[model samples]
Target: MNTPPNPAAGAASRIPEVATDASLVVPVIEEQAVVRREVVETGRVRLTKTVEEHPETLNFTLLHDEVQVERVPVNQFVADGATLPGVRYEGDTMIIPVVREVVVKRMLVVEELHITKHEVPTQESHQVVLRQEMVQVTREPLAPPTPGPPPAS
Candidate 1:
């Protein structure tokens, strides 16, 4: 006996859906709340310290000597190619730690000099000064406001 093949099974299947306007469709958006933080910068004064910790972490105190100039010329920025405004004992210290993989050079100063940086939130108020000037004009001073009601009667 011969068997007959099913015609519906041989055809490809399609998914079912409803027709809607493409222009009217809009993607949903999520609104989120975010908080911000306040960051403050401060100053400090310190000297170099080399820390060597085995099997843990090591630190290298990178430092430079303090040199003072007798006379400062106009606009030092133009004179020095480097942007260093000046040497000040104020600001954050840059501590670089030494690791096994990193190659570094260590130098020992002949004298351990004091290093200073402005403390964090350093004397910024000092930068501003309010000076009040009073001018005394000799003009009879308005006769004391016309003697003010007959000297309290």
Candidate 2:
């Protein structure tokens, strides 16, 4: 069977028969990832604060210091060059010496002061008001959009 050659193929074959020594430049294609972000409101939260107060009774012990002072006479003569007595403590009492020069050029101890300290504890009660803040949170969901009438033609 003899078939006539296609006119388009004959035309394309006779167009060009090029012998090239140059390299072919073909563009390479690749896929790249692009990231984007958007904000959407899903729900709403409402916070409420309230202050509350209440009465409270406080109880504790209080300490008080009491001091007692007493003077005792000690009219005693020391030697011509004896050293004067210094302040001394016996247990919790402090004894302070008082010295004076007599007519005979001798040192005399006139009187001594004795001081003692005492601690007294007392129970105390007081009424006071205490305040506290309270917070309440309420979550509301987004309401669906209502459908409106169609736009005017």
Which candidate leads in TM-score?
2
Per-model C-alpha RMSD = 41.0, 7.6
Instruction: Report the Cα lDDT for candidate 2.
Output: 0.89
Q: Which sections of candidate 2 miss by over 4 Å? A: 1-34, 145-153
How accurate locally, in lDDT, is each candidate? 0.35, 0.89
Residue-by-residue lDDT tens digits, candidate 1, 89-151: 424433222212112332222222233343233222223334444444332322233333532
lDDT of 2 by residue, 1-153 (tens): 999999999999986655587565568999988776667578899999999999999999999999899999999887766788999999999999999987888989999999999999999999999999999999999888578895454
The most accurate candidate by lDDT is 2
Superposition TM-score, candidate 1 onto the true structure: 0.12
Question: Weakest 10 consecutive residues, lDDT, candidate 1?
Answer: 94-103
Task: Give the TM-score comparing model 2 with the true structure, all chains together.
Answer: 0.67
TM-scores of all models?
A: 0.12, 0.67
